[model samples]
Target chain A: MRVDYRPRRVSSAIAVLAAAGSVAALATVSEQYLAVGISLAGVLVLAFGAAVYRRGLRVLGVPIALVGVAVGFAGFGVGVSLVGVYDRSFTYTGELIGLLGLPFIALGVLPVHRRLSRRLVSLGFAFLVLGVVFTGAVNGTGPDPIPLLLGIVAAIVAWDAGEQAINLGDQLGSDARTWPAELSHSGGTAVFGGLSVGTGLVMFNADITGLPLESLLLLLGAALVLMVALYK
Target chain B: MSNATADTTTKARATNTDAATDADAATDAEVETATSSSYGQRVSTDADGDDLVVEGERRRTGRWRGIVAVALFASAVGVLANTPFLLLATVPVAAYAAYPRLTGSPSATLAVERVIDDDTPDRGDDVEVTVRITNTGRWPLTDVRFVDGVPPMLAVREGSPRHATFLWPGTTTEFSYTVGAEYGRHQFDPVTALLRDVSGGTELEAEVDCDPATVLTCTDAVPEVPLRKQTRHSTGRLVTDDGGAGIEFHRTREYQKGDPMSRIDWKRYAKTGQLTTVEFREERAATIVLLVDARPSAYRASAEGEPHGLAYNLAGAEQLLTALGETRDYVGLAAIGREFCWLAAGVGLEHELTARELLATHPVLSTVPPDEDPTDPDEQAAELRKRLSGDAQVVLLSPLGDEYITSLALSLEASGHPVTVVSPDVTSDATVGSRLAGVDRENRISSLRQAEIPVVDWTVDEPLGTTIVNSTEVMD
Candidate 1:
């Protein structure tokens, strides 16, 4: 049997994305009964994508991953329309959605294809958003947006950390001497994760009383600073 | 007249000494200075000077940018939806964006000291290398990652040469690793050091210079090689063609006036009723030259981690030389490469040492093979013919990986030197190319054997002694 062992970056990225996609789909399905079909389809597509990617059929794997994303969005729309029948509390629904993305977060972090893994992470976050937003829209009382936003932030951080870890693993695979540099880089990224969680908690409690125009101007300034800081 | 001659000799000796001193100074200067380039950076300095410093540009990976954009989008959505919770999502994004300000840029004042347990090691010996990195700058480095550049050819035997740690001002950290030495001069690759901020947003990569290189010499003291059935016209252990006064009897000849009493052949004389003398087959020393094929084509290995065919041929040549030397036969050394290397045939302790040094340290048989062939086949063969004595036999050590080698062997045989090939098999059946190469090699070996040249097909899996014994038995 021909094993499709791709470059370290490609394989790790693919694995991460597939895992994240699975988690996102599971989260959406648990929020609404109507979303079960879409979740199943997303899961099926991602699983196939992983299989084909491992088989060295990258051309087929990517398309399958994309199809899963489409299925996930379709499921979100269907779940929103049928959310009235399910009378679960917003907190329970929100917690389940948050918990559902965990498996995908774990999977997304696996060393696979870097690009595909990133895409899977985005898809997973999309599924979480879809579930929370639809449940809120149908219930006429949206879930606590703070917790939902926190979950999205956590997913993004996980994806970033996973990417760094996979990249380090690739470096280590090529040369053991690269471990020091890779480990240091990984440690630096880990600090970001802690900072992100801390900032989220602080922002959840802080009250910002300012004029709308002033707030918009402040946000624009912050965006410009962020762009400048992150510019390569 | 004696005084004048002595004065002239003294003046000449003084001038020669001055020239010798000047030459030694030039060579010392060259040895003291070394320069190397890695990762697009060039470093040049005296060997005893402070280590060369290479600095890289600070670059951002743009990871936090995506989160920042998402935060901005969420804020906009929050304003429209009148949800404060949506706006709160931007907190982590803004914090990550500003995290770089908490840490300073990586310091350039980093020193690397590399120490090896053995600078000159024997082949296959493990050498332990310790690299100590010190932070000389005032700022405390939050995250410093370094990988000691080990040569690609050497295999790490134990431990790791990489480390990730935090170093304060005037602090030092070290990592140690062991690598198995192979025959050749191996230069350590520059140590790659990467400095990052606490947020991992910015990176500064640099290559640090350490020690120059390590040299490994493979030595052969005694090698037991099986001899072929056919022996040349030589007075040695091998029985030869002509009859002379020796232990092995040839025939009974008519007794001459000067015949020795011990060789009178009394049993033959008693039976024939006539005086007779015993004659034995003549045994004389044979002049043999061992030629190792160090051509670019012969530098191939069957597997990635295995030594190339040239290495095997070198070892085989050493064994043959040792075996031949034991029998008190005149043995010489020659290499077929870009440049022809030849040593005159002689027998003695001094000559053996010279042969071993030539085989081990000759530039032609370097660890890494040269890219281009400097000498053509005709020129190489002509040089070999010119160097070899009229009665000297040739022992050609080659992989027969290419057609040119077969032709070269044939040319040597045609030039009146009896050629015995001890080809080290370096082809495998792993891939399609390798399988085809194996077939090509087999064909070449068969063609050489068909041309009346005695070929010892040596497989790497078997010992040289065993292979030579089997080939000799087959020839007999």
Candidate 2:
């Protein structure tokens, strides 16, 4: 009767795909197909580990996660290629794939340690966002903006859905039928992501290239005030 | 409002501030008084007679704090890097941060009722429990998570006690689970409900007291109890040392003038030309007292979600009492726990009924472990020794968790009473401390055996009756 909090199938799918999307964005900017292949493979292997862990088989799950992490580290070693297109070219973007290994390992352990896995998942998402920014800003060639924005949005949605799944597992055990709540939560996150992209598109169309620094500062201050008002 | 609080407090019969205050805001005092008057004060006023609602503490889980921090970080990075794509990501993050705040806190206006399929089930039968919850409030509960309080003594065999769903205003939701019934009566506790807003923010927690206080009573008579050779002068099942007229064989003696012809050993007489009479072992009743260990230390369970040691000990006592009742032997019950309990040994249908009833419902033998060790163990033992008759044999049902129980068994054996120890093994190897405890329990069991007490080592995995039968056979 161990209550397992391993992310369900839907949440696990979102997290893996968003993580891959992050790596793919890096690959799209740098033309590194090898890194994308290696990262996606790591994601697939981690999925297997999550499945094995859910079946209460820790003996097999641990080794599978260890192998997946080893593969991911190999990718990390290969992804750190210097291009020096922007002010800083020290791209640790390879860690976007490597960092997820910890969470994948946490996902398979019995009585899934909620706090530790949560921290690891957030840490992996942070690495993904940091890598996306670095890969977009420092590409020797002109970086594509569409994939970069999609990658960032995907990262946030992935974290949201994964966290929701963990909580669902905690509150209602694995034996419970919890798809309705999980699906609705994930759907909400996906819709929110779409709205964000639309907002970004609208701001892009407004031609902010000619705006002055003083106006940008004033806009930021107004936005801060609005946030404070809404918070209350 | 004060009137409502006072009424709710009286009905609940518990010193809970949350139930009192929460009832005051939503329910009127006059309506509450009318409901209490009609229902006789046990049922809550918010819903039907079955449901009792008490508000619980509220706290933020802070699940989305990382998203907020990510949004701030992305916005700072985007403004410096002049990247609008990164800046766009901050919009969704900020929305996530605001979503929970915009959603109103869910109210604790829910009516819950639990229905047990069979109130009196046979041992090992699966008893189904269905719970129905209705949203009695004006607003819908977007995310309602609840766990039914399945009795600890019963193991859930089918489905889950936990559920998460949404219920609109005046709508109902249902979930059911089945538990395998064991011996004795098991009472269900309150249902714990956690209500979260649509955005999974602002949780309202409460305990719903569902009536009519479902209790599952499972009883099965044990066919035989292996008692020691000690016996009373009364005719009963136990074979005694004194030779008389019985089915089993004993030694032969020289024939007397009044000896019956059927009892004469004709073959022996022909071999030695001697008149001899055959003597058979006598059958007599045994006065047996069942002592249960209900001390707090005996409440340990081997694993999570399993019944504790005292639960198994009591169950064993029930089986023994039922088996011993069918025979001519006199059976009595006693407990060493928070409160002292004793029923004098007697033999009859009425006495059997009273002993069984007390064994099932006595406060000292309650399924819930006591809060503290109020009585001195030595003093309780002395009291028990004073109450027991000189010819009575003691059958001690314990877990042998500590050395004190082993000493109790030894002292009883030393006091001229034939003692038999029925120990339920509840120690596990889940941790270093638990493993060490298991070893310690093993040492105590071996020491009791060394003192010549017949120890029935009952493992939880096997049936208690089978274990008892097998162990007693080995002892013979």
Candidate 3:
């Protein structure tokens, strides 16, 4: 089957999402010092994504996208500060927004069809979610569990759908017979996503405080078996 | 009565002119008398006009929409959740999406022009080509990148064909490059241009039609060629065959009725009571047909950075044509390609010109040689045999890289036509495959020589003229 591999676009899309999630999480942080470090990481991720997407420009694309993103963040930050409404959250968010440039830079420089880039993108999003959850816990006034769960579910679905779309487009580009393959692939991904969301909801609601160690071990074994079955 | 007839013809001609004048008077009086003559001249020359073919169009490659949409969604979510950080992501995406929309389509107003230093260069001459791109629209083009479509036959000698620049309205940007001319008629391809906005989101790709009239016609001059010593019975520069009325003495014979008085031996008459006649060998011209193997397999070069075998064959053919022309012999040309190409044997200025033009521009003699022959070897040979004169000799020019060429030569020799192979060596010992090919080629040449067909195994490193001369000396 013909497959048109476009790793750059897919990686860039994931990076954009991760940077956005990082900015949203950093906006609520009270400690300015911690926000600065997190914001810089977000900016780096955005720059990497920008670089990856503009790979045709070669080494030149990396610097162009990174510098453009940095300049954009600085300009926005300065404009907001002039308006007298700049705060620790706004500064941190601006810095995190700078992270959107990472994808552009990554897209420009990274080679296509690399599994590592995809894995890194997924990990980046995971880190963003964990950071948000950690911030909420430290504040002692966390977001509602249901909305946060829905958001996470939405994020996962978007990411999976984007990946599938890229794959489908690539197959079509290569003139491959994609209808049957795409249909089954999409169905499988949807089922996995639904099961994960359902399990997360169940775990959140279930009262495990009084459960015995033996029973907990039994639940862990059952979960492992379910995961294996799902994998196959 | 003859005077009356002449007067009658003159009157009729005058009346015809008057009739033409009456017809002209019926039309607009402003029409000049020279118009009719000029129109006739134009109609005669219009048969060979240049053709302009435009290919490719501007199309949008939507690469950035998905990312923009995802960024927008994230920003909306951030606004709803009172998170300023998510809104920051919307800034870059919005700018990227809006940037392309700000600049309307520039392809409609873009004009490309190609200029070459020499359109009709000799073979091996370097030609400089300059491509100019101008924006005719009112809006300035923020980013532009273009790659010139250089002909495949020619290789770039200096500079690159690709360039990137930004142009303002009514401004022009150009890039120049040089390419080495090869033997063929090369038509320039259209230049491909890609224009993008400041945000690098949307791209408009277009194939710009440049100078369609720009063409390079590279021709080789005839070089000194060497031929074999063997000659047939015909009137030519080669002295051959039995005794006749010629310079060198053959034998004395008894005087016959048709014997001229000058040929009678007066010394023999004084010595004995007998009349003898003197005879000399007759000199006859060779009828030769130069055959070039343009098959796909014969298109290989000796190494990575060398010209292909077909180029060498053409040079050899040109040389042979010159040699045969000097001898005032009947010479023709044939190329074995997808289709069998033949030029009839003749002797004249027009014939030489036609042969040279065919060698330089025939579709069978493409710069980027074809890989396979459409017709089988047997069919091609039959076609070649049909066009060949009965006693005409064949000089086969090939790389001998493939076995089929050897078979073709042997078959022609077997068919009563004396065949001489002038094979250009296009194999090297640098690599194993090349080494094997070189050995195989050597075997083919040796086998042909064993069959008594004169084979000139010309090496690529040696000059063609020197090789031909050495081979002829060896044959002698």
The TM-score leader among the candidates is 2
Q: DockQ for every model, please.
A: 0.19, 0.28, 0.03
| Model 1 spans > 4 angstroms off | A1-179, A188-232, B1-239, B243-282, B342-346, B361-363, B369-382
Query: Highest lDDT, which number?
Result: 2
Per-residue lDDT tens digits for candidate 3, residues B1-476, read 22322322333312111212233342222222223332111111111111111233444444334434444454445434544322322333333333334445554346666778887898678899988777766787655666676765577777667655567787888778889886555656566666655333345666665422246766534344444445556677766656786788888989999889999999999999799998897777777899998888778887654668887787677667766767778888888877777887878776776676566545676556675545776787888999888788899999987888888888888887889899888888889999999899889989999988888888755666667778877888
- lDDT for position B435 in model 1: 92
Query: For model 1 chain A, where is the 10-residue window of minimal lDDT?
Result: A1-10
User: What's the lDDT for residue B366 in model 1?
Assistant: 60
Ranking by DockQ: 2, 1, 3
Model 2's TM-score against the true structure: 0.65
Say what the interface RMSD of candidate 2 is.
3.1
Q: TM-score of model 1 relative to the true fold?
A: 0.54
TM agreement with the true structure for every prediction: 0.54, 0.65, 0.53
lDDT of 1 by residue, B1-476 (tens): 22322322333312111111233555344333421222222222333323345687777655555655555665565555555554555565566566666556775567766777876787678888878777877887766777777654467777766666678888888879888865444446567787776556677888776433323333333344443334455567766656786778798779999888998878877898788888897776777889888888888888875767987787677667767778868888888787877787888876775676566546676656796656786687788899888877788899998898898888878877778889989998899999999999899989999988889888876667778777877887
* Ranking, lDDT, top scorer first: 2, 1, 3
Fill in the DockQ of model 1.
0.19
For residues A88-128, write the lDDT of model 3, one tens digit per residue: 44434433432333333233223233444444444444444
lDDT of candidate 2 over B1-476, digit per residue (tens): 23432343254322112233344534444334434442212333444432367788876766765666666676666667765555555666677777777666887887777778888898788888988888888897777888887777788888888877777888888889888988765667677898877667677789886544556777754557878788888899888889888889998999999999999999988899999999999999999999999888888999877889988887788778777877999888788888667888888876666665555446677676787655887888998899889899999999888888888888888888888888899998899999999999888878887888889898877777888878877887
**Fnat of every candidate, listed in order:** 0.28, 0.32, 0.00
Candidate lDDT (C-alpha), each: 0.61, 0.70, 0.56
